[model samples]
Target: MLIRLGYEIAIDCPQPMPVISLLDVHKDRQHDIKRQTKVLTSPFTACDVYEDSFGNSCRRYMAPQGGFQILYDALVEDSGEAEPCNPLAGETPVEALPPETIVFLLGSRYCETDHLSDLAWRLFGHVPPGWARVQAICDYVNNRLSFGYGYARATRTAAQAHEERVGVCRDFAHLAITLCRCMNIPARYVNGYLGDIGVPPDPAPMDFNAWFEAFLDGRWYTFDARHNVPRIGRVVVARGRDATDVPLLHSFGPHKLTTFKVWTYEQESYPVRPPARGIDRTLTTPLIG
Candidate 1:
């Protein structure tokens, strides 16, 4: 199936500011793109594109003072399959984990493995380790926290989200990732396009989604503590220790968001979308302008 994905975001700043954006699809999905518009901006500025440490495609450009806007549109092919479930994928012992996967087992900016280590054992020690344990964490998080756009907090950490028991999708990912790491599992944060492809349409305006991956049985497998069920049309753009590493946009200066909008759907279901919004504005450099 073909899916249309894009976003338009506008912000206001007091002065010109340098910003980096991770709006491009991940390199792994580059071959899946059927067509795309180069990331475009209002009041065009010079832009440099490069790969970040985690291999995520990144765009760097300076935003002019006042209102600035950035937009991207693309059509990508998908298998139209739901999230894969493999309860048989057993957890890898820490000593046997790949070097790269080791980083995911430690704490990061939003995921605090140290803070949640003891709690993780107390809550999950009895569960059979491996895929089932990961699913249990997802089940716990999905039921513990109330999800809503109003619960978003840019600075919230996994420990804080656990205590508050209220958060947006990122919080769910953070809390889940933290618990996985504490249990000696390699779990990393993921953010990307998740269209309402095989499910009913979401009435709320679309936004990039947050989830996580656990390295088990020699590979990283997708898991969403927020949804707690298999989902389809997940298009990954970046992965890292937490939201801090994969911020859709990071600005060097303060800015005020005046408008934001996002859209993702099967090509045939594309709507008449408004033209103001940006990708993952929930975590930044904030957004353009």
Candidate 2:
């Protein structure tokens, strides 16, 4: 299916700010199941912007601003061409796992004690098959937690979310990632947009959204335990070991915030490109700190 995605983010600071930086991973990948037809990025004013690729081979863009507005737009075409089934079905389970996936499972900070991993294993014992394990964990998280604002800040961790049993999309994604990793399944945090299903159109944008992706069988599959539904309208900005790696916005120095908004919509009937193969081996220049 072809999709047109638009994303806008605004920050109203009490005072004119000194510096603003953005790390955007909004570009879609040409992979076994999806393709990128057209992509574009433009800032509202004069700013230094550069492109790079991260360890996972995802493309990234960095832009800087000061007490201002930032707009990002991308027109991508994704075909739902399915890839080969994950090869983990019959091989010795240990041999089927990827090295990166294993690292995420064992090395992520979220998998520490008293987190989702501990609770999930205590309740479910051993993980079932790939699909079954994901489904079971999804159901557990959805039933155990309630979605509400004011529970915690954006920086809250998976351990905090597990202790409180309440949080927004980010917390849910973090918890899910930790649980999947504990089961020896590779999972990562995703940042992006999810348009309101009921609200009328506002020229301004909406709030950012978060979800988790799991390496199942042999490929990454999207899951949103926060909504307890399959992925849609998930225009990914970045993917990382956790939320700390893919923040939608990061700022330094003190500045008062007046208002912020995000807007997104889907365009129908765009052109779709064929999937590209082979590892993406390009190196990324060090980001401006």
Index of the highest-TM-score prediction: 1
Which candidate leads in lDDT? 1
lDDT of each: 0.87, 0.56
Segments of candidate 2 deviating more than 4 angstroms = 1-4, 12-25, 29-66, 78-96, 107-117, 196-205, 268-289
Candidate 1: global Cα-lDDT? 0.87
Error of 2 at 107 (Å): 4.6
Model 2 agreement with the true structure over 9-96: per-residue lDDT tens digits: 4454454344434334454642311322222223334444444233322323233343454433444444433323332442115567
| RMSD (Cα, Å) of model 2 | 9.0
Runs with alpha carbons beyond 4 Å of true place in candidate 1: 269-289
